[model samples]
Target chain A: MHTNEKTVAKILFIVAVLCGLSALSLADVVAGNGPSPLIIFDGSKDFSTSSVEFGTVYRGPVHFTHGRHINEHAVSCGKCHHDDSGEPINDLEFGDGVDTCTDCHYEETLLRGKALEGMSQEEVIEHYPNAMHELCISCHKEMNNKTHTLSAPEACRSCHGVKK
Target chain B: MQKKNSKNMKNGVSRREFMRFLGLTTGAAAGSLLLQAPGLAAESSGATLPKFKIHTLNSTAEKIYKCKPGIKRFNEANMAFKQVGKEIGQPFFHPLAANLKKNVANSEIGSGIKVDSPDEARMHLAFSMGAGTWNNMFGPYGEGKENQGLLSWNPLYVPKDLAAHPLHDPNAVDLTKKIKQMSRIYGADMTGVAKLNRKWVYSKTCRNMYDASPARTKPMVFSDVKTPRETDGELVIPESVTNAIVFVVGMPRASLQLSPSSTQTMGGTGMGYGRMGLTAVALAEAIRSLGYNAIPCMNDTGLSVPMAIDAGLGQLGRLGYLVTPWFGPHVRIGKVLTDMPLVADRPIDFGVTEYCETCGICARECPSGAISADRERSYTPPASAGSCSNPGALKWHVDGKKCLRWWMESGNGCSRCMDVCPYTRMTWTDNYDGNPDPDKFWDLNLAPFGYQSVKY
Candidate 1:
């Protein structure tokens, strides 16, 4: 009835508004720079494979061994790669090559949308590694039943730091 | 915490304690407490109200859980981020789009999607005021025909299961069984129980009297604001009604499959809505018949999620929908909260997380991108419940605001994602091979019929 009473009500409404928005599910994984980018590995286009002979130099499209990962982890393709529609940042403009996992799984993004809403590409890439680790490790623990691997190496070098 | 009342009015203690006391046995004690502490009692007697003062964030909190500006104008604004080719009034339409949008509009915002903003608000107000709306499509059976016969005049009374009646008297058991049985007869697909957890009840959303006597927190004429508590800031269970019987009514599979295609989609959703109304009426009437207080709810009042979870109806899933074993996310929920005692169901964990991770179809297909991309890292999923920001919880909390916006923006209430959810598919079959035998279960009659029956 009073001005103060109305103000208090407004503040309470604001808080509820914030809480309601964040109440669905928390984003814990990082996509590109924030949450781990959900990788959409197009088995047809995204990857190429090779059985290289000892002295042959293989300079081909950046072909990841899509079959090896699925067979080794006993994972259905949907786990690591989802259909393009589920990308956390719908504007990624990448039809099938999107890989921001943390965008949907990061605690902040899960509560909020992609954190780097208007940031540059470089800024996101800077925070990408930590976000990826947090995202991947958490899934590893909660979803160990599905995957054979016990843990992902903490170091970024483990998965990305390889050179033949 | 409840404030005290009475200064040794009944005992050697202060007047506040007597009024604030939470152990009162009758109306006389409440009257005395109020008389002893006029400030604590305020405009009414101490014997009527609860111990706490009621306050809502704003008038809007009474409207949408998230007080988003867009929510206030939800019908007017097309808030979704649409792709280039998918503009409004396009020649080539997304076949399922129209139906899905209408369904979303009916449930989330209510009324048709393009209803003028003010008219939409009026429609919402009408329903809220119990005036009912044309789009409401269903109403309590006895309330009026304006409700489209969604509910029965005499609620479906399920006699409580006597074996689990909490009362010591043997007669109460018969009454309980009567209530439970009648609920099934009224078409409740499944039902179960859990104790009335007071915490799930709303603390201050509606009008109520809180007797300051600190002696008892019991409400006297608390009728309007009946919902399961989750915002009590504490998960307190009421001493009375130690059980909750939750029910689910399945929607037609044919209609749901044609989601986003306005006409066909409404049948599925309408049935679901009708089921909720029907169930609520039945449960409430059944409880009332037993001479116990019961509240029937189709959508308004207490939080349904926790009650559903505790009642063992379903588990929270990745798309933020209740995933029940029998119907997945395809069924509609309606509940009746009562003081009647009954047996409780256990919480189930049937590899929803595993399934969600392997089948990211719902999250992918979400046009508004509300479904969470992450799997459950720990036991909980981050909250994605409200408007812009997702609530940080243990499961995928869809951004209801974004989802609603997309529905409006697309000019068709959308259930594309719900349609695509692997869980939404009817897994139940007579074959018993743990899979639907496509030949028998997947009706081929759908495709041709659906294609031919377009009014738009």
Candidate 2:
């Protein structure tokens, strides 16, 4: 009876944790999104590491140097920034509202993946990391879809230096 | 204009008709009178050029290289800039971007910076090559804001005097000498001429020929020429082109001598391209001023290497670069196709093929192992088709596919093989062809013929 009670408590605790994460994401969705800075995750410092590593099967941290992208490269700010809806937020400039990408992507609920009263349990699981995978990666695909060579990093360790 | 074989065809539309079509010949009241001249074909205005037998194709390069219609747009070949942005993601673009932009914004001379660590340094180099190089010059040119690059490549509003005039020097020898002299004056390191082999010309221009032909003149019925007319996205060249005048522009040998993956390495290559564009424009205008319709072109519409070889500029080296006796492989080539009468230079037999039989330095030094280390030049590229090589020729081919892939990885156009080439080091920096020795052509048989032995 004691072991059974402990098992029930652990399951309840995990449920509570999942619930807490969803609630925070819901709050972020209500606030909406603006912009983000370039982030590098080496798997050591606890940033919101994805259940999938950069949207892959492995869970490694990605290395991205922001100074090169925004300032050095001419890809333009509009390529990354977007509102909660599919609408793009093209008004953002260099270094404007720059912060952690996970501040909104990992915590906020993307408007596209909203839950309704009649939705299934799988619908609820569409949260932070899923939204990132949909947005940033697809943009890269759209840019290089017509070319011959693989322009964007689609593999596991391309952006993420290694497992660590 | 073309001379010697410029026989006026009896029923063809004359240049007068073309001028009238361009609206330059406003006084067309004479009607059929201008068209009735029987002996008009005998006049000096005929734009035909004499065909000289090109002796340069007598080498192994000729036996291997086959002529094709044309090449596809190098959009795929030019994907080096875009691939890095996506593979590494946007974050890699900016932090390295700021430093790269700042470095170029200053006068781009010398090895610019030394970063904190090797990683940071690499990131900086990547961003610089992707975003900071002088790639601003190579693009389509048109009216107003779109004409951000070289306009000479396009046929916009040209004066009548410039396009249709009597050849300034009717003598082919004097004209060739003056033209070569003027080429060097406009920054070409070496210049040579040849009877243009039509096989070398693109049967049809690949897409993106920019529709800048004279037929596309606006406000005239000939405006169709301004728009590139492609049967199926393939551009075609008119048959008027007869003589091929090609020139070589030297790169800063010191920069390429640095490490291949370094910023200085790529910066030098980029700088050469930008400089070549300028030289081509200047050379084209000089030819035009001499009363010839010269079409200035770079690595477009045809094969530059083969054309350079046919023009007696240099022989093909092991690494596929045109190894001029003076600068070796450290040069960029440009050319102007014209009808102006000029003497063709015979191809030199300096024994580059025999030397390549023993030398394997470039292939061994290649970072991506793209070059073949074999002693013999094959009829086809030694590397497979997937390695970025176009099949059709047999030569000591480098794996261009791997070469491009390496460039994508290094964040710069890798010139690692060029760094250690012994020939690039022996460049004779002079005002003209410095080696005027009668036996300069005989040094190929010698194991090591030091220039110090001969009077400088």
Q: Where is model 2 more than 4 Å wrong at Cα?
A: A1-164, B1-135, B138-158, B203-236, B428-456
Locate the minimum summed-lDDT window of 10 residues in model 2 chain B: B34-43
Q: Write the per-residue lDDT of candidate 1 for residues B1-456, one digit (tens) a residue.
A: 011212212234344643443132223123212111001111121122112111111121112122223222111011112111122222111212332233334542221223334444334223222211211444321111211143322223222231112333426455545555555545555565656555444432221111111111122123333222322232222345445667765554544453332233333454455546655664565454434545565543345555676665556666766666545676666677666655555544445556665455565445445565544322222233222232223345565544543433332334545565544442321111111222232343322212111111
Interface RMSD of 1: 25.7
Each prediction's TM-score versus the true structure: 0.44, 0.50
- What DockQ does each prediction reach against the true complex? 0.02, 0.01
The DockQ-based CAPRI class assigned to model 1 is incorrect
Q: lDDT, candidate 1, residue B330?
A: 62
